[model samples]
Target: MEAALIAFATTAATLSVTVVLALLEFRRRRREAVQARREQIVGRVLDTLERATRAASRAPIVGWWAPNELEYALLLPRLLAELPEQDNAVATWVARRIQHLQAATSRREQVAIGADVAAKVVQWGR
Candidate 1:
């Protein structure tokens, strides 16, 4: 009877450890998945912004009024808000550029802001 009890206790302890390890692994994987999704969203926003910048260069005034520009302007704030505060320098830089772009009143100012944003996005890729 004592031997049986010892064996049962050993088995229970092993199972408990396994359960704990599995739970830890699950949590880790979930966090990684969330980070991956956030990165994907950030990439999309950057790509869109880059494309809009190119479009803006073609026609400084008309490009600012383009559909792509409007879409990017609408999406940037929400994406910037979603980014984690830590290790988010690129997001922060983009946010500042967006603010500058929004505050721009002249075509030359808009073009300059677009070029600056494009340069930062290129730098971030490295």
Candidate 2:
């Protein structure tokens, strides 16, 4: 009886560990997929905005959109919600400041804005 109990306990322990590891791996893969989706969305946004700016004969990082306006900021939530993924909080946050991207007057400011937007890729799938 004692040997049987020990064998059963050992099997249970190994199965539990296997289950936990599998769960963790699934979580990690899901996270990576979400991040990839967000990066794709951001890329699309920047590309579209750049094209629009150029077509309008405006500079991408300067004077394409008005700067520091509370009114234009209101469009962010709508834009984010309209996306296929409604839970994209990082994209929502980015949309909040996106209009102002073209407001940067200097090259340094443009670079900073670019870097800040790029860094949001790691924030979350949501």
- Best TM-score goes to which candidate? 1
lDDT of each candidate versus the true structure: 0.71, 0.58
| Candidate 1 lDDT score relative to the true structure | 0.71
Any idea how many clashes model 2 has?
A: 1
Span of 10 residues, lowest total lDDT, candidate 1: 117-126
- At residue 38, candidate 1 shows an lDDT of 67
Q: Any residue pairs clashing in model 1, and if so which?
A: none
lDDT of 2 by residue, 29-119 (tens): 9988877766676565555444433333445455436343333344355447645665666555676556556576754565556556555
User: lDDT tens digits, residues 36-103, model 1?
Assistant: 76667657766776666666567656764575557667767776676667647767777777777767
Top-scoring candidate (lDDT)? 1
